[model samples]
Target: MSVTAQCPRPESRALRENHPVMGADWGPFNVIDTAKQDWARGWAALKKFTEREAHARVPYEHKEGAYPLGQWVAEQRRAYGAGQLAGLRARRLEKLGMVWSLADERFQKNLEAAKAYYDQHWTLCAPRTETALDKPVRQWLSNLRRPGALDDHPEWKTAPEAVDKDWNPSWPADWQRHYAALRERVRDEDGPADVLPGFTVHGMDSCRS
Candidate 1:
């Protein structure tokens, strides 16, 4: 049985006030995935990397690469802010660099691949500011290593796969078989087999705690 509990929504003001970076400008980081899967995945990867590095939920706008990382740096440097990691020692960029280096080997590989993906797919922002795509891969990786307060977001990024909203999971046949076996219990001695299934019964009690 599920409890119909009324919990706070993601749009709650208390939460929003706590997350000062949520409303930052998306600016000109227009990506080319018309389907938006690339944007979703890239953001997810960025969030995952942040969580693993700091063991907390870091927030940022979905303005592709530059905006989010820069936002993260600013919040982290407060050193005592809610977003900053506990007991943070190194200076902002140095600490960020150490975290970048500490990422799992697989994360590093995926981040590199994401850099290529962005290079090929991302379109230049209108009134194009800089030729970010022209930056070499080494420079791309280096930027993430040591960031400054106003530094542009790092390159070589990736994200988790976007979810398929239209997909629905059907009941498995194995589960149906197990349910049928349990239904057979009605005929054994405890209940009537002819009775229609309903919420009236909770079934045989488990032997284990």
Candidate 2:
């Protein structure tokens, strides 16, 4: 006769079965997985924004369907700058035309406003209260002209200079505006320009010498 030998289950397995610690009520939670899902959701929102705007330079206060996409973008930039962003994620954002530096983005926007002002007036000597492209052009120029304002980004000066060589003239901006008006009048008129005291053109007094 052949006898069959039965092996007893491990004590730990019996304990686990009795305690039911690994039942459906207790499931594993992965924080990394949750964070990845959140990141993917933000990326989707950003992708949609880029599809519509053709760029990922989201404003600081922008939102996409209740998601703070701009804040997410800013956080990504910070992580990238700190070398904490994953390489794949950075590449994906770069592919979408992400503007990493807010300062550079702001400068480009202001430069566009300056260009528009020059196009309209043929000069960049706008008054302090002047606005162009919904931006405070004169105030932006004043800020750029402050001492050491562009110390870290000296190359920014060349952009405005390219738009107008005398953008940052040694003479007063008001004087430049008057000179521009006078030149325009001379060009438009057929005879020698007659300049008398108290004469005004383009709302500027020609008598103020």
Candidate 3:
């Protein structure tokens, strides 16, 4: 009777531990995919906002649903400024008419308001307390007159000038207001109107020399 030697079978095992190969880990890939998805979602929300508002100058506190779209826009501007934004992403934002600088956008918006005020009143000498299109027209004008306000953006000065050549007159705003009132009265009378001293038109003493 040959006794068969019961040999314990060697345990089946890998030649090495299951260590991930270099650059083959899915952890980094998953993180990148998640970031890309988040970005795409933000882009979609911004596209909708631009389509409805006709602009991408979203307020910093604004949001779309639960998404902080305005914050995303600000991030994009920061990234672009730092040269970290991908070219394709920048182009996509530009196509949506994104305004990278809120300051510049505000200036343009105020300029439009100034133009509208001029169209209705025929002058840009609005009172300091006056508002046009919900904008502080006089205050904005006052800011524009500050030294070096337009040094870096000289082209902006031309827009107000085109709206009204005397928008930034050398004369005082009060004087211009009185003069405009007097001129309107003269035109209505179709000749020289007898505007006596202390007489007021639209709250302005137009007859005052």
TM-scores for candidates 1 onward, in order: 0.16, 0.66, 0.66
For each candidate, the alpha-carbon lDDT, in order, equals: 0.38, 0.83, 0.82
Cα-based lDDT at residue 170, candidate 3: 89
Which stretch of 10 consecutive residues in model 1 shows the poorest summed lDDT? 160-169
How many clashes show up per model? Answer: 2, 0, 0
Leading candidate by lDDT: 2
Model 3 poorest ten-residue lDDT run: 10-19
RMSD of 3: 7.8
Where model 1 places Cα greater than 4 Å from the true spot, the runs are 1-96, 105-109, 115-158, 162-209
> Candidate 3, after superposition: displacement of residue 120 in Å?
2.5
| Candidate 3 backbone collisions, by pair | none
* Model 1: colliding residue pairs: 41-159, 45-159
Candidates ranked by TM-score: 3, 2, 1
lDDT of 2 by residue, 50-108 (tens): 99999888987999989999899999999989989968998898898988887898899
lDDT of 3 by residue, 132-156 (tens): 8999999999888888889998768
Model 2 CA deviation exceeding 4 Å by range = 1-38, 49-71, 83-88, 184-201, 205-208
Model 3 per-residue lDDT at 8: 39
